[model samples]
Target: MIIQLLLIPALVLAVVSSLRSRTSLRGQARRKILAVLTVVAGVLAVMFPNTLQALADWTGVTRGTDLLLYALALVIIYLVGSTSVRFREQEARIVLLARQVALADAALRHVEAMQARSQQAADQAPVAAHRGVEGTAAAR
Candidate 1:
């Protein structure tokens, strides 16, 4: 009886934590519905432990606990696979963004270098003109 009571709060905490951590509205809603269903199922399990055994027997499983364990394992595997896929996708996006930033920085540096060269040439123009005048006057 104590174990059954403990399961309720444990399930509630797990669901609450999962729900709070979700970033998307759709995800949260889906989680909320699943959580509600899970809690209801838990309650039903506590109220009628024999039902699990009945289900196990109907499904050709030897034991209810084994059935529960199998289901839990499948859920964990799915979550791990999905999380890995999301991580890879996020990593790819980060790499692409980094490359774009680097390209933009390189273009900016090239433009600045070109501007600096033009300014240096402009600064020498008057000196060149002065030298030409001096040479022409000396010739006259």
Candidate 2:
């Protein structure tokens, strides 16, 4: 009786879903396959819920929905933890790269300062040497 009651809403949803599926052949095909599979599984579950229950008991799961929710929660937790670790690792890498860039910039400034000092020494050396020569010539 409840299944009969469920049929109207299900058919309405299916029709509305089909109207939306005209945009993509793959989507339509997927929906058709899903509908067939859903009907087959629903009939099987209704007929043999006990058989599936036995399998679940062997597997130590009290209920199928409980097992499904547990599996989903485990996957979500693992993904979120891995994503957080990867994010922190990337942030550390970025900070290290920034420090390396600053070090390179400072080294460039140091090299420029050394080059200026070299130029000053080269210019003064020639002038000082010529002045020494003039002093000796003037003494003579």
> What number of clashing residue pairs does each candidate have, in the order they appear?
0, 0
Which run of 10 residues does model 2 get worst, by summed lDDT? Answer: 14-23
Model 2, position 135: C-alpha lDDT score: 96
Candidate 2 residue pairs in backbone clash: none
Lowest-scoring 10 consecutive residues by lDDT in candidate 1? Answer: 13-22
RMSD for each of the candidates: 9.3, 15.3
Residue 29's lDDT within candidate 2 is 85
Q: Per-residue lDDT tens digits of candidate 1, residues 52-134?
A: 88877776678878657655654455455546656776788899999999999999999999999999999999999999999
What are the models' TM-scores?
0.62, 0.48
For candidate 2, write residues 4-121 as lDDT tens digits: 3444565555545534423367865875676577577657766887865664565567875554454345445544554565577678889999999999999999999999999999
